[model samples]
Target chain A: MKGLTLSQRVAAKTILVIIFLFKLRNRATRKKIAFGIARIIFALSPKTRKRSINNLRIAMPDQKSDDRIRYLAVTAYQYIVFGVLENFWFEDIEYTFEMDAATKALITSGGPLSIATMHLSCYEAVPFALQKLTGRVTTLSRVPKFAAGLHSVYAKNGVCCVDKSQAGAFLALAGKMGSNGVVCLHSDHFGSDTELDFFQLQTGAPAGPAMLSAYAKTPLLIAYAVLQKDNTYIIHIETVSEFPIGQSPKAFQFAMQAIYRQFESIILQYPEQWCWFYKRWR
Target chain B: MEYNQQLKNVLSEILNIDTSNFMHSTKLLGELSELDSMSIVLLLIEIEKRFSLEIDIADLEAKHFETFGNLASFIKNPLTV
Candidate 1:
């Protein structure tokens, strides 16, 4: 707090207040609150709103109508905000797991693996639920000073939370995979490790999941959560590449492209759930 | 020294850095500006392709990539380390 700027302090305090208020309400009421506040935040932040629309138009050139794009942007922001707020009070959030028979057997076997998750609705639901099953779930999060509550929530869920800002965070994640631990990383965001074709546009994506899977000699799975009308979440986990793959730029790009393909399908299925504000197509 | 030279060649190719001075004891993560997050992954890719070795990716950590020698050692035999 001492090094924070005036606006940063205000933002942090506002988040704390939102977290506190969210704790006082049920899931249904909280979703409604989050949606309303999300709208207000969207309206107030011109830069964010503009970035969201710009990204949408770039990624979704087929959407000709401005109104439809704006609507999609707002709803996506609402879902992202709702998901972030849900992390603070995850103890009460309801979610169900969806994985195939082979994945279940593999997970139940408690073998080391890498999970690539997106920033969809309640994205952390995958790791949270996996911890309940295998008790070996590990997640890497950029936990700043203000997001300590998020760190605590993961701790409370019996998930090992590693700080991404730390020097050896990637090491910790890989080490977790080395020791039969399930490592889940959010891979939807921008990165320079691997070039990918996302939303029909060329973009750079993190190669951590694919690299870990191939280099560690483990399986790779892509998971996402869809928000339900009942305020519950349905988390879907699908294997991207389960078998061994060659370690090379070509192999990493192939694996990452496979992931981007799945992401495109999920985003198309739930247009209002994926974040559109990311500077995805640079 | 041969393995060290091979590792240096991989690093030079992936990172586009002059590795003439690179040695087994050379520091990587903090010392080299070119060995960023992306380079780290690219390094592994090239290491596997160059050596025809399937590295145990799960066994990788920061220390494994901290020094040129560390990576060479791990790639030589991860199970022993």
Candidate 2:
């Protein structure tokens, strides 16, 4: 079979939407159908399947049974599908956060604070919900060219998305930080220029957040919204420390090392929920 | 006062591997499967923490981390004459 053209892919998506609208009244059936479609896609992609299994094996080495690993892999696939669906219709979703006073205080502090999050289940909603509760939010994100419509929807919902590919994006983010705006970034993803670490065998992670905080003289806040079995969310927020203001680049790098240490702790705690299939430690 | 031993200790801690079988000539990337991209970054961070120095990503080369001795030498004398 030939590869799908851009217009054909769009048309296929349109058909899926039409089917979704036709089954809108039957929400449970729609969810089941979505999950079933996801399972089919998951099984068809050999590379994704292999990567998912490898990730499961590495993360849960103690679980020796193939059945267990298979279960986790399937769950991971379901999560990706459901997450994409949810993100598409984020405005209609309602989530509850078990936030402590300290978490709330950190957001309300009105300082340029940096949040380091991973690509976990419902990761996008975490910031969206927070901005709705607290106020406007600024987040560094790599905007997908094909998802322009979805990106606009997120923007309409008040998410200040900064394109990571552009050099000026970093400067803009730093300027926003200096002006006492909240800047949230996903620190776990690998990049071409990023430094590698334990999350994967060979990974490259962008040092933008660290660089921004150091340059802007802002406090770094480590935040993640962990999905619970009960279908509720826990927004884990902690004020790690402030970057040494007016310090040398070396001092800033040291401060970033400390921040990444804290990030490693969180990723280790919930390894499965992370985007492990990513070539993170590569 | 050999820097190789210090480098070994740091590697052992960072990679969470026993250094008993490790030698100065041990290849960091290909030979040791544990010294992956993530581990490499973590090792860099740990080195920076321990030595109080900064290393740019541009400064890194495969040769710099090819062997334990190379890494030690780089850390000991990062300046190029």
Candidate 3:
């Protein structure tokens, strides 16, 4: 369009490419092709690869071998690349959900919930699967300007995707929580809101999940997914807080620390699946 | 300072905005350029300390932050909500 901004114009072209990718290839073939191309990109992107390796070193200080570190970093990139590409054809993917008894009751009983998730393998699978069962899953994402149309993809999957770049995105997410909706937010990223210890290092964390759970008078839960060998995702969900956090700022900060401990363990368990490319210690 | 002015000072400090000119009807959440999810955390913490009130109540919500007046009222007496 004559009046379209540069990002909007690029977004239009990018969406066309996404649609072409979705239409021309079968799901398996698409995944294979995506993985093949991802390897090339990962190889070319040394900065990204180096960052992941360095993050892994900080997180897993015991992993001393440089060769091992690089291996872990490359595999993580593969997972990240495929996980991102799967969003283009999410509806066609397969996944299985697993929750403990407490989590089951909390999720199935169905009230307002605040789910804190990570950038693990097939991270969106948690929300995608939940939306399928509850039809109440809402997610807030910082969609890049070039991929802004991905909002419609989330809508097609029945996920109420809110762009985090917009003003009042916080209020929108909090509103959803107050309205008996399951709001899923990615919490394994560094932020300037509340300070916490992640991987034994002091870093700020997003307080949205804890704050929303307290504000909405609902339980806060953490969920994650890892892709299995058969191209199926296994989603695991667990509770981080049952009662509403009543201690205000102290309780809020405490709750985030506990969540980070859990996240550290999960990321350690699935080293090749969790995203370590972020400049987390900063 | 009155609770309202105290609240305004906290908001201005946290969001790095000039709320001295803000009226009761002035919007806080969406309209303010610096008021994002991260800054909201800082604001809530500061409000709890300065107002001596916990922001953990179920009745507290985004709508309360719709305008400066509503927030000031909520901090003064949440039971009004």
Top-TM-score candidate index: 1
Estimate, for each residue in B9-64, the C-alpha lDDT of model 3 and write its tens digit.
99878888788888889987778768777677567767777777765433546777
Q: What are the per-residue Cα lDDT tens digits for candidate 1 across A75-138? A: 9999998988787777787888789998777778778888889999788888898888789999
Higher-ranked by lDDT: 2 or 3: 3
Candidate 2 TM-score versus the reference = 0.66
Order candidates by TM-score, high to low.
1, 3, 2
Q: Model 2, range A1-282, lDDT digits (tens) per residue? A: 035578756865675575557346443454566668878987898888788888767656677899867766776676656555566666656567654677567677766677766677668876787678767577876755544555565786688887766533554565566556677887766554344444334445566555555545566666777766655567777766544232344454555455566666776676546665555445
Which run of 10 residues does model 2 chain B get worst, by summed lDDT? Answer: B54-63
Decide which is better by DockQ, 1 or 2.
Answer: 1
Model 1 error, position A230 (Å): 0.3
List pairs with backbone clashes in candidate 1.
A215-B57, A216-B57, A216-B58
Going through the candidates in the order shown, the clash numbers are 3, 15, 0
TM-score of chain A for candidate 1? 0.93
TM-score of each: 0.87, 0.66, 0.85
Error of 3 at B32 (Å): 5.5
The candidate, 1 or 2, that scores higher on lDDT is 1
